[model samples]
Target: MRSGYSAAFKALLTRFAHDTSGAIALVWALASIVVVGMVGAAIDYSRTVNVKEEMAMELDGAVLAGARFLASSTDIDASKQHIVDTFTQTAALAIGDAADLKISPADVTINETEGKITATVKGQVQTAFMKVLGIETMNVSVTSQANYADKYLEIALVVDLTGSMKDPDGSGSTRIASLKTAAKALIDVLIPDETSDRVRISIIPYSQGVRLSSSDASAVTDGYSQRCVTERVGSERYTDAPYTSEFIGGGSGYMLGRTLYYMGYRLPDLIYDPEDVPEFYDRYGDGLGACPTEEVMPLTQNRKTLLDKIDAMSANGGTAGQTGIAWGWYTLSPNWNNLWPTDNEAVPYSNEETLKYMILMTDGEFNDVYKTIDITEKDCPGYYRRGCTSTTTKTWWYEHYNQTTDSSNRAKSLCTAMKASPANQGKGIAIYSVYFNPTSNAMAEATMRDCASSSRKFTYASNGQALTETFVKYAKEIQQLYLSR
Candidate 1:
């Protein structure tokens, strides 16, 4: 039996060991193993691909964060921190396993060009199954950038409703009427949302000065007394609007009209009453009340407020733009009190993400100002050849020239200060100055240009149509600045 069994085992071994005859089965077995290995590899490859995709997405987020940080500040360290933070957050979300593995991440490269930021990143992901085949890890990378842009904006419109704005339009519509139509159109473009506090506009209709709404007027000072617009039969100022104008406060050019960008706005209660004369004169620069026909309204985000104010605006009063400019700047300025959030708490200024701006329009030259004849004559440059021409009190043309040295200097100084003020220094607040029906007796075009943020920002309108277009153009430019960061 032992012999027989040994012989049988030897025979079986010989059969299994046969090279030619048994080779086919061996080949078949090996082929099966190969197929199984391929299948397993496919599953692992799919998982690795998914992991790579997630990593790429995470890298994208990291890049965007870096770009946003750059947009907010010029600090390199801050941007780096933002990049790292973003990458870390994304990495956490992308990493799938609880087991720690070696991770190699590329350094964030920030490329700033032409006021834009671009970010690039690279990283390597370890593979679980693929590593068994001598592959240690998979390489993955991605790049992305944010425009670092400003999405929304806050604009303040300080319009001159003086008699000049009433100049008849060639289309039969008066300058004021066309202005209203144009202003309404501007509002349509300005407010993506009627109630969105995203952007707020304050309308100041002034002849000699701006008139705040009854609410604003009462708050600034004793509105019951010294209110110019409500009481003055000829005044066109809107009391409900923010008090003051660049001109009224003793400013010149658009400097007197653009009070919002620099001085910001002051509450009515803070200013003294104008009607009280000697007692109020000290603080009278705040501005007068609106005429019976004067439009009275406060800083409102509603489209209706702006449209209605434009419609109700009527020409009256002497143009005192100095006070107007100071007030306009006051309302929008960060320095103002009680005008901030109702909770008296600070909020992140988002769309205000970029800068603030103001568009000032006037139909006529500064005919009414605050300085003496000698001062006006000296400051007029070439514009006031009549008044600031000489120091003599008996000048022949000084009386006819309304632009006083005090007002001219005030406007110039206001412009210089507004553009250079700390709050507005880098705000890039562009001032567009429009002088309609420019007279040789008034400030020259060059002087007007000087009153603006720059030559590129100032404009002069020789006619009513030009005046309308000028304002429309100003609105368009400001809109672009708001839309593009």
Candidate 2:
């Protein structure tokens, strides 16, 4: 009887072990399902987040367009419909047939009294694997608001017209050509209808120096004949101080002599005979004559004038970016308003109703800087006696001119002061810098980076198309008034 009981117990133990193995297998199968479901949920969540982010961006764009339209449109219902239509089209392009995409005219609100437009977009993205976990769809909703503040804008487009701009961009087009096209497009958007007194643009094309009208140059420098001028020196170098006679002579002597030398004429005391001078002088090589032929256009509301100035731009000179930056500030400075036309005067820095912007664009380094020298009797004894008979002392004069600080440093200093003007209630000029450098010029990039108001205001373009796009983007941003969440 004991042996029979043992046999039965052993068989029962064997059956129990077999059942335990089957139970372990069933548990693992259930865990596998759970693991797969978790992974699928994670994927669906990621996709939903991406779609939502895209929707948010698209919504922001839609509202910006709506706000711009509302600024000009008198019909509120029509503007609202335009906003809805714009969203639908952009959504189709960005989200690609999102489930239950919904944007109606009611979703866009227009406040005429406040000059504001707000828009909302709602949609759902169908889930693939989350459906198994009872989440059939993920909802996405985004709202964007824009204010058409109607504030006046004073913009300076400081462009590089250096010799390198003659080089072909990545798209096989000259940089100057691309720049003109892009700049004209910007003018079109900002000063639409050519009758907008609310927006004024100044074109400052600079090379080794910025060109002024001959009369303006003379006025600023107390009879400096050259149309081009370099960076100012002394206490008011970076300030928007009125160009009075006291400050005008600080840098005028050097400019006067240099301009005369490059124009194939010598100073009255140095020249033996004025009739011997050539009518034209080749002013390349040493960058002495590296002044852009394109003269600066002061703040103007005329779209045609702005466009024409850009079209007439020709590139042939060294890069003097500091001069460009200085002129950019001057154009928007109220102190220099007297230099411009009465109707084109810049609004005061204290004016809360005006927004000032400077777009500083360059393709290469700030390699040119003006130097000053005091030539005395000892330096040129013959000048006091018989005067210089030939160009024998030209090279010597060039070498003796005292060099100033680094051009890049000067440019950055000007940029800093412009962005932190003491006069504008602590809110100064907004600077946007564009570096169109396909060659990856590190120093140029660094200088431009330092010049921008913020990281978001700096842009780099490696090709002609990209350069144009950057200009257009900044133009749109500048015209947007103000945007918020």
TM-score for each candidate, following the candidate numbering: 0.47, 0.66
- Per-residue alpha-carbon lDDT of candidate 1 for residues 184-238, written as tens digits (9 for 90 to 100): 7667655533453345566656565555544554444333312332111113122
lDDT of 1 at 408: 50
Candidate with maximal TM-score: 2
Q: Looking at model 2, report the run of 10 residues with the lowest lDDT sum.
A: 394-403
- State the lDDT at 469 in candidate 2: 85
- Taking the tens digit of each residue's C-alpha lDDT, what string does model 2 give over 1-485? 99999999999999887777788899999888788879998998898788878877888887877666543335578768877888788877987774434433328888877878887777667777877768887777778888864566789999999888998887888888888887887876776565465678899998767777767776775564335566666688777788882233212112223444553422321121122332223212323344577788889888888888988999876776888898888889888887888877888888876788999899988876654444443444332333233443321212112122378888999999998984346678989998996788888889999999999999889988888788888877877668888
Q: Which runs in model 2 stand beyond 4 Å of their true positions?
A: 1-66, 69-113, 118-146, 245-279, 282-288, 376-405, 422-425, 481-485
> So what's the TM-score on candidate 2?
0.66
RMSD (Cα, Å) for all candidates, in order, is 14.8, 11.6
**Cα error, candidate 2, residue 451 (Å):** 0.7
RMSD of 1: 14.8
